[model samples]
Structure formats: C-alpha cells, structure tokens
Target: MRADHPLRAIRQLANESLAALQADFSALYSGMGRPLIPPERLLRAMLLQAFYSIRSERQLMERLDFDLLFRWFVGLGVDDPVWDHSTFSKNRDRLIEGDEAARFLSALLPQPRVKRLLSSEHFSVDGTLIEAWASMKSFKPEDGTGPGDPPTPGGRNADADFRSEKRSNETHASTTDPDARLYRKGPGMEAKLAFLSHALMENHSALLIDACGTRVSGHAERVAALAMIEAHADRSRSITLGADRGYDAADFVNERRSMNVRPHIAHNLTRAKGRSAIDGRTTRHAGYAASQRIRKRIEESFGWIKTVAGLERPMVRGVDHVGWGFTFAATAYNLVRLPKLMARVT
Candidate 1:
C-alpha cells in the first residue's frame, strides 16, 4: 500500500484524537473485566464502513480479515483476529448510547487547524430527510391497532394494505421506530417514515462546522437551523446566514436579527399573493449574492453523506442512533476534505 494514500492521513488524525479519548473509553469498560475490544478500534472500523460504504458489520469484519487496506485503516495487523460481527454490533450499541460519535465531532472542531479554517461570520444551513428503516406497514396507531395484516408464506410484507389510510404523526407511529414520522418534502411525493438532518456549513471552505438530526416535522428545519447557527456564531459579532426558501419565515428572520445576526435567507415571493419575509435591505448587499452562491455547497455534503455513506435509509431505528450516524457521516466528510485543505496550505 502506498504510504501517501488518502486514508493514511485520516488514520494518523484518528489515532491522535482517539488517544485523547482514552479516559472516555475507560468509563465504558470496567478495569477489572476481561479487556474488551478497544473502543478506538471499533470507531476506526466504523469509519472504514462509512468511508468505503460497507453494508454491514459482518461485511466489514469479513473485509478486515483479509483486506490489507481495511486492516490498516482499522489498525488491525495481518494476523489480528477480527471481532465477531455480533460483538462489534453490541459494542457499537454501547458507543451509540454514550454519544461518542457526536463527541468525537465536537472534539475535532477545537483543533487549531480546523478552527483556523472555519469562517465565523458567513454560514449556511439546510436540512434533508433521512428515510427510516421502517416500512409503511409499521406505521400504526400507538394503541396497537394497525392498518391491516400481511398474508403468510408470501415473503415479508406480502399482503399488507397501507394505502387509503390517512396517517399522521399525531394519530400514528412507527412500531419499529417510534421516533420516525411520516413526512413528504412536497406535494405529490409519497410520505415515508423519516427523520430530519440539518447541517451548518461555513462559506469560505464549505466545511461542515455543525450538524444535527431530528424527528421530521414542518418547522423542524427552521428551528434546527436557527439553533445551530446561533451556537456556531459569536454573540458579540454580527454574522450572515444563508439558507433556502424553506427558511424564509417572518419569525425566523426576526429571531436571527434579534441575535445580532444578519438573515440573508432567500426570499419566498409568490406570484399569487404573498410578500417575502426578507426585503431589499438585506438582499441589496453584494455579500447576499455571494452567500447565496456558496450556500448551495452544503448540498454537496448532504449528497455524499446520503449516497456514499449510505445514510439515505439507515438500518438503525431511533432518533439518537440515527442522529449519531448523521453526525459521524458529517465528521467523515470533513475528515476527507481537511487533508486536501492541509496539503494546499503546505
């Protein structure tokens, strides 16, 4: 394997940061018991799965057994015995419960180089739906009554009738993943069980500085965007926020201004009979146009996370688990981009 492989740089960075989380790992495992598979190694393996689009833990372990590149990225030697897929799954559940993935991303932001590259003034926000693992049949009343039964001996979901049912989050819930809500992005689109993922990306480097996942709802995007932008911005300084027409709300714009942040949200003018929340006062600035141009870059991050990382329909069920996966995927996107940015600086 080449020494200068792109992943080798990621491995070096992972090792440096993993070492710092030693104490956090210690708390997850008792000192007296048989030593568990190292949390750091488990996380590294997960990163490999995200990077290479490995479908499952079993498949990842299988690759680690023989593939030199997979072993190298995961810090396993040629003769090292790979953990059983079930054990890896159990350990991952523990890690997810502890929210390590989100914390790992948090740790990365404070690093000197990453902090320097981050643009504190100009940022963009957007959200996408992460289709849940559940099926339409699983969405039923919280009282245990479902739409209909599936015929046996016809494979899974053979005869379930989910059509002609008016299901809403208020009246129905997914038995498999209660946190997932039935949502559709627009008219004529089929509603599916899904969660909302939001990202706050800086304009200069188009790097994701913050991200979050939430239960799908109409106002969730605007609510999450405001919270993430506020958290990322310096309170003393006025920052500019770029967003899509979905964020063009009077209340959201007013709130951004109250925080001393300029709302450069895209205007949502309707030809029929609606005025935009944003006026020429904000849109007249040249920076507003520049912010609009850079804001679309956030979609690149989303596209990679969904297609490359296979987060379009996560196997895990639950808001926290889904959120952690989204957060880790965002972190992986940054890791891939950071190496290139660092090389340019040198």
Candidate 2:
C-alpha cells in the first residue's frame, strides 16, 4: 500500500508532456489575475476531454472530480476538486490562440543530425472540413428577433412585412455564427459552414509540430501545410514535406522549391485514373514521386484530433473560436503524445 500508485504514474506522464509546451510565450491575455488551476493540468484535462468527445466543461469537471487517474494526470490529489468545466471554454483561448502548442510540439520534435533511423520528421499534410456547430437554420429568409429577442409581430411567413430574411452565405451577414461560411468539398451536394484544421506531425514520433484552422478552400490544404513549414522556419535542404492531391498545385511546388525544401506531393490525377495511370506527382521525378508516397502520414494527425481530441466538429460558433478550439485540441494532442514519445526515447 505504501508503494507508488497508479495515479502517480499518470501524473508524471502528464506533467512531463506539459512541461514541454510553452504557455507563457503568448502575449494575448496577460495580467488576468492569479491563475486558479495549474495551467498544465487544466490544459491536459481539456485535451483528454476533447479526445473522448465529451462535450461541456461541466462534464469534464465532473469526470475530473470523480476519476482518480485523471486527477493524477493533472497532478491533483484524490481529494482535490478540479476546476469547473467553464474554465476551459473561458480561459483556453488566451493560452492556445498563438504559440502555445506549436512551441511545445516544436521543442519535442526537433530534427536530429545523424539520427538516420527516425521516421517522425517525414510528414504528410492534409486538411478536412470540421463541420461548424452553428446552423444555417439561423439564416431565415424573413425577419425575426435576434437570438432570444422574440418574434416580431409576424415574420412567420415570407409574405409578412419583415425586417430581414434568412440569407445564406450567398447574401446577408449572419447574426449567429457569423464567422462561419457554407463550404462543400465533398463529392455530392453536401456542404457545411466548416472550419479547416491542418496538422504536421512526425511520422514515427507521431508528434505534431504545426497546425492551422482556416476557411479558404481551393488552397486551404496547401496553405496549412505551408504554415507548418514557415513555423518550423527551416530552409534547410534536409527537410522533405508530404501532402495529398489537394496540394499538387503548382504554387505549392514552387513554394517548397523557394524554401529549399523538397515537396513530395501527390499528383491530382482524378481525371486520368483509368484514362492515364495510377501514379502522378511521384512519377514525375524520383524525389517528388518518392516524397508523395508518405503524404498519407498527415491524415493520421487529423485522425488523432477527431478521435482523441473530441474535435470532429467545434463546440463554438465563430471561425476565430473554432481556430482557438483546434489549437486547444492540438495542444491536447501534444500533451497526450509527448508522454508516449518520451517513453520511447527514454
């Protein structure tokens, strides 16, 4: 009974990973009184909760209050009442919106010279539509009370005298989830007011270094991948980037070339599949073609976010909030991932 406990093991892992991140580099929310909960524990719990898809701060708070392992992961004792869930939704933006996770993901996955056996640095970049939590339902064609106001005499029908009408992104400014826009990237008519999330993780380490939340289509995937490159701020010839067909655009290739990094991007050969051949970009050059082979690794990053960070869709409304949310999830991902990576190196 006197020996080290299960919770102790979990706490050690959580704190180690947290220590890898830099929450202080942020210049956003300063002088916000004394911190009530330890930043590391609070951040880790958010990561765990997001990964499990558990919604609401109250739910997270309840779990932490009850789960001994979770308490330990955050370094709270069995008797400690973890901070309430609202703390996450409230304070998280300040910590995550900027350099928090990237600072840590970067520190944990720095490139090593003569470390020829590692595969984590070989990254694949891809992006997906994180369906917005808001609704086009708010985009009514007729006037109505702004959220909680009340029905104006009669906006019940289109024929009625109305001050406003439900307008799609094709028109009027939205009073709800205004930052979201209708986006359809799927094969069919399906679309969403989506925010895009992109990640760059070490293939072997599974440690994510850079991530971005954006709404611009056509180029969003490549833009995010480029952001990762820029964040690393590396122009060294040793780094090679991977990405799917979405990034097969000429600009991406030129951009990578300008940076002195190799682009192993897949060829967008959808039109020539049966008409032409199986391989596209990878077939063009020995290195380009070979580089494209590993772009699939980036998909694993998003998989971890939705699977482990509870962010298949954001809980918040605006693009800014969704961006913040993705950052939190990314930070959470690192918190969970760092421990396992350390275990390997140790």
Candidate 3:
C-alpha cells in the first residue's frame, strides 16, 4: 500500500479514538462466555463499509479476505481467517446496545487537532429521509382488516392494490418495521416508509458535530435541531443557527432566542399574507448573509452520506439501528475530510 494512502490517515485517527474508548468497549462484554470478534476490529470494518460503499456485510467479508489494504486497515493479518458475514448480523445488537457508534463519533471531536478545526459560534441543521428496509406492501392496516395473503402459489409478493383503500399512519403501520413512519418529502412527492435523520454541522468547517435518527413527524426536523444545538452549544457564549425556510416558525425562532442563539433563518414569505418569523433586525447583519451562503455547505455532507455512504436507503429497520448507522457514517465523513484539513493547518 502507498504511504500516502487516505486509509492510512483514517486508520491513525480511528486507532487513536478507539484506544481512548478501550475501557468502554471492554465494559460492553462479559468474561464468562467464549470471546467474540473484537469491537475495535468490527468498528474499523464498519468504517470501511461507509468509506468504500460496500453494499452488504457479505461483500465486505469477501473483500477483507483478499484485499491486502482492507485487511491491513482492519488490523487483520494475511494468515488470519475471515469471519462469516453472519458474525456482523449476530454482533450488531451488542454494539447498538452499547451505543458504540455514537461513542466512537463523540470520541473523534475532542482530539487536539480536530478541536481547533471546529467553530464555537456558527452552525446549520437539516434533515433527510432514510427509506426503511420494509416494503410498501408491508404497510398494513392497524386493525388487521387489510388484505391477506394471496391464495396463488408462490404468493410472497402477491399484488397489493390500494385503489379504494384509505391508509394513513394513524390507521396503518408497517408490519415489518413498526417504527418507520409513512412520510412525504414535500408536495407532489410519493410518501414512503422512512425515518428522519438530522445533522448539526458547524458552519466554519462544514464538519458534522452531531447527528440522530427519529421517527418521521411534521416537527421532527425543528425538534431535532433544537435538541442537538442545546447539547453542543456553549451556554456562556452566544451562537448563530442557520436553517432553511422550513425551520422558519415563531416557536422555533423564539426557542433559539431563549437560548441566546441568533436565528439566521430564511424568511418563509410564501406563507399567508407574507408572514415571516425572521425580520430585518436579524437579517440586517453582515454575518447573517455569510451564514446563508455557508449553510448550503451542509448539503455536501448530506450528499456524500446518502450517495457515497449508501445510506439513501438504509438496510436497518428500527430507529435505533438506523440512528447508529447514521452517526457512524457522520464520523466517517469527518475522518475523510479531516486529513486534508489538518494538512493545510500544518
């Protein structure tokens, strides 16, 4: 492998972060039973999946078996036997139960080099829909009065017609993944069974500071934005939050002011009689205009996440599992960008 390979820098960062969390990983397991795959190796492999866009654990395992660079990055030797793909499926619940993905992400930011690249005063927030693993046909009536299995032989994917049926989240739920909510992105878009994934990005560096997954709802984006900012924002100093027109509401704007955070929200002028929660007082500042321009950079993070990370349609089912994957992907995004950022500062 080349000395300047990107994975080498990523591996150094991952090693440092994982080393800091050694005790945390050890606490998640008991000494009584047979030893399993090390959590550190599993996490490194998961990062590789996000980095390379490998679609499945089976494929990841296959690549690990022969790819020298992958084996080296994962801390596996040439003579080591590759574990079965099912090992990932079996051990995933343990990692989720331990909250390892979120911990790993948190562990990255406090590093001396990374902390300097972060901004203390300006941020942006947004949400994206992660299509659930369940199919539309799995969305069934809550009362169990919906259509039953077809009598035709090999009826696994029998036709499901909703021409005359009225189905909604209140009246129906996906049997395969009950936590997924039926949501539409906007007017004229087809509704899908999905969960909302929100990210909080600091405007100065365009690096994600926090991320989470939630059951889709009308106010999920605004609610998540407030929660993330509250957790990460310094209470002693004022900050600025930039968001699109979707977050321009009286309640949300008021909440930000209550926390001493300036609301750099875009005016939703198309509302009734041109009502807008943001007025000239907040918009008159030169920083507000700069924020609007920088805020769009958050979309680059989302684009890489959905396209390069293969999370546009997550393979996981429940919200917890989905959130775990989302947070881990965010960590990978930072790692991929950090090497270049650090080099410039040096």
Please report the candidate that would top lDDT against the real structure.
3
lDDT of 3 by residue, 33-112 (tens): 87688999999998999999999999999999999989999999999999889977677778998888888989999999
Q: Candidate 2, residues 129-230: lDDT per residue as tens digits?
A: 788887655454324433443555555522332345444555634456666677778678765667787777655555556676787466777777887776
RMSD to the native, candidate 3?
Answer: 1.1
lDDT of each: 0.87, 0.61, 0.91
Global CA lDDT computed for model 1? 0.87
| Better structure of 1 and 2 per TM-score | 1
lDDT by residue for model 1 (1-346), tens: 8878889888877777777788888888766755578898899999889898988999988989989988877878889889999999998998988888877887777777777888889999999999999988788888766545745784665565556667789988888888999999888998889999999999988988888899988899999998898776666888999999899988999999889888888878753467888898899999999999899999999999999888999899999989889998998888888889878777
Alpha-carbon runs more than 4 Å astray in model 3: none
Residue 193's lDDT in candidate 1? 91
Residue 315's lDDT in candidate 3: 86
Q: What pairs collide in candidate 1? A: none
Q: If ranked by lDDT, best first, what sequence of candidates would result?
A: 3, 1, 2
Runs in model 2 deviating more than 4 A are: 1-14, 20-35, 97-99, 110-121, 140-173, 232-238, 270-290, 334-346
| Model 1 alpha-carbon miss at residue 102, Å | 1.6
Q: What TM-score, computed on C-alpha atoms, does each candidate reach?
A: 0.95, 0.75, 0.98
